[model samples]
Target: MDKYRDRSNTLAKERLTRETDKQASQNMAQWLEEFEATKDRVSEIKRVKSRDEDRYYELLDELEITPEYDRYEIIKGYKRDVDALTKEWLKATTPAQRDSCVQAIIGLKSDMVRELMNTQQ
Candidate 1:
């Protein structure tokens, strides 16, 4: 009877190990799927960003403004900074954070306007 009990215990242990391995394998597969999906999403976003950048340059050319122009380039830098700040503001969950973003954006816009005025004069 003792020998039979020992055999049963060994079989139970083996079964438990198999179940744990199965669960681990399933979890790894799910993680891989999620990783692949994320990779695809990043690739799509990069493509869209590339297109937007190309369009921006095209618009600049259409307007006859070369990037070599110092004043316009400075304004462009400010615009980029403001755009980033706007995105940050949109993502901010707290009012204080949003306010900070707004202030930064306002400052950038003010600087840009000042630069524009100087260029005009």
Candidate 2:
């Protein structure tokens, strides 16, 4: 009798767990749908602005562009570093030193290009 009771209890718990998971999944889907609708509504707004508000939004737009400008600066810095490395590689008196500089330049350029591509996306 106790063995039968234990089996039944386990079955009941499993069923309850499955139902809870299903309900939670449904709730999450509904929440995501509502969130997307809210985002769409926000994007559709077209309001006229006063000069001060326009200036404020312009500053905000500039703030958004800041990362792109920073990335440009980073790329420029990488180019400068790579150029310096190239000159060093050229002027190296020893083959070993030249090889080392070549490796450094290759690694730096690869990293810089990867970063540039990733940021553009």
Candidate 3:
């Protein structure tokens, strides 16, 4: 009777484990589908943004407009974001906080064009 009871308990434990795994698998599958869809949309947006930025710069070149820069030759603009992110990065004390600051900086850099500066001082 003891051996039979132990066997039944084992079987019940396996059944519960399988059920939990099945639910987790279902959730993961749904999340994967959403992730792929979002990834594709992001790629599309990047392509369009690239095309538009190129067109805008080309027009500026054709119109004989020269873009000016500051002391370091970096473009000057009203960047509330740079201030916010600088504060966040300075105040970040955890790995997760630092990682978020890194991500934000990378995202901000993506939209900027690298400017060539004259070094014939």
Runs in model 2 with CA error above 4 Å? 1-71
lDDT for residue 94 in candidate 2, whole number 0-100: 100
lDDT tens readout by residue for model 2, 26-61:
342343344455444333332323436675566546
- Residue pairs with backbone atoms closer than 3 Å in model 1 (clashes): none
Cα displacement (angstroms), candidate 1, residue 71, comes to 4.7
Give the per-residue lDDT of model 1 (tens digit) for 1-121: 9899778756754553344324434342343344455445445545665669776555545434422244445555665676676667656789999779766765665565555446546
Query: What lDDT, from 0 to 1, does candidate 2 have?
Result: 0.55
- For model 1, the stretches where C-alpha displacement exceeds 4 angstroms are 1-71
What tens digits encode model 3's per-residue C-alpha lDDT throughout 49-77?
56697765555454333222221223223
The lDDT of each candidate is 0.55, 0.55, 0.46
TM-score of each: 0.42, 0.42, 0.32
What's the count of clashing pairs in each model shown? 0, 0, 0
